[model samples]
Target: MTFLKISKAAVIGAGSWGSVLANVLVKNGLDIKIWTRESKQVTELNEQHTNHHYLPGLKYDERLVATDDLAAAVNGRQVILLVVPTVAIRSVSQKIGKILQTSNERPLIVHASKGLELGTHKRISEIIAEEIPEANRAGIVALSGPSHAEEVARQDITLITAASADVAAAKTVQKMFMNDFFRIYTNQDIIGVELGAAFKNIIALGAGALNGLGYGDDAKAALMTRGLAEISRLGVAMGAKPQTFIGLSGVGDLIVTCTSVHSRNWRAGNQLGQGVPLADVIKNMGMVIEGITTNKAAYELAQQRQIEMPITQAIYQVLYQGCDIKQAIANLMQREGRSE
Candidate 1:
């Protein structure tokens, strides 16, 4: 199929991932507008051309502009990328929906955020669809995988996936963002892709906790591998294809998020394992650690699905039940043996 033409684009959320994707589009010669709730970010992007807080010391292209004008930034754009946190998806999409209500143009809506919504346990795409009018969107897409905004800011070679049931919509994003340093593969498994991306963060926290506890490489490896199994089990139960868990959005993302220093989720987990209060860990990080919230959501999801997720349960205990970290580890190690 011929890919959709995307000349004008608006990226909602001037966050690290949002900024990186906006910069990539600008490099590809697309006119892009980045929207942030903060007026300071607008000045920094327009005058300084940098988001120092998120991508420290990394300069952005002059062509990329940040705005607090949500209506102006979103109206008449061919593409609107939602890169906000999962929690903000609904509100942001509602704002976009209001702006889209005034126009007939249907922009291809895409999201780079990972994690399931807290109360509803909805996927980011599902939340977007709920708020945005169907007639105002060409199609919705989820862009996720192993790519981190910090690494992408430095032009690191990053591989990620763009998923949509609408093949043309996915291809449009793949063409718009794919470049030498960043490559995007197209996938039709939105369920698997979103789940893999969300579930991995939960595991990364566990992996980081192990690291913080001074566990050796063997322990981390065991956590990651077994964590993948737990993720796949619940993913399958949730109607995701089993194989998608082994693909770029699954094991690939798990490896990067669990081990990479740039992972806020991992860092947050590390702090938690070091005996820092969860609130303090979040406050000190100065960024959203998706896994922290995702852990709660995943724990609830596992129960709803009646799936066996000992790792998730253990981690949940440590975070919510005030279970000691050492006890959590000991409990995990003492579980009944099962076939691999």
Candidate 2:
């Protein structure tokens, strides 16, 4: 299947990643529009060329524009990128489906969000397919990897994965966003790609909790190594390719998120380790800590599948139960030793 050139695209959220993606399109000479629910951001992005609240101190492209009206942002676009938080994806997708159902164009739908739906345990691709009618979509794609919006905004060299059951759709997206500073690889294991991307946050938060508790680098290293093991176990149980965890979407994303200063999940966990209440840590963050919610979902999933996920279980106790981070770490440390 071939098509007309992907000239104009719509990025359906104006948060940090969304804004950076919109600017990437502009950098690649595509006409782009970013939709935000906040009216103030429209002026800030369109007039001032900035997004101070979500992505401070970064000057966006003047050619890139923003709007509060979702319909105006998406109509007639060749590619519609969903960059909203995991919780907000369903509602936004439902709205997009209604507006575009009768339209003539079947635009490529890509999601950059990383997290499973809490109750359904669904990936982003599944959620989009449920809300957006297949007739109105070219194909569903999951764009993920070790990409931090903070670094991407600086035009730092980044490599990422674009995965879809539809190989053509993945290739289309790879070309759409590839540039000198950013590159893309295509994958067919959508399940492994999405799961690895989402599950790494659990490990990152664990790393931060260790840091906040004044633990040495040795402890963090153990957590990351063991973290990948459990994440791969659960992913395989759920039909994902095991090797996908060793690839960019898995270990690569895990390292960056667990170690990067820009990781909000790690920061939130650090605050928790420093004795801040979970509610207070989340409020102070002023950003969606995907791992906080993902912990609940992954823990429940592990139980359902009877998967051994000690790290996820420990983090879940800290976030959901009243278990102290120290106690959680202690519990993890006392687990039965197994050969690697």
Tens digits of per-residue lDDT for model 1, 79-187: 9999998889899899889888887667889999999999999888899998999988889999989988888888899999999999999999999998899999999
Off by over 4 Å in 1: 1-3
In model 2, state the lDDT of residue 28.
96
Tens-place lDDT per residue, model 2, 195-233, is: 999999999999999999999899989999999999999
TM-scores for all predictions: 0.98, 0.98
Query: Relative to the unseen true structure, what is the C-alpha lDDT of residue 229 in candidate 1, on a scale of 0 to 100?
Result: 96
lDDT against the true structure, per candidate, is: 0.91, 0.92
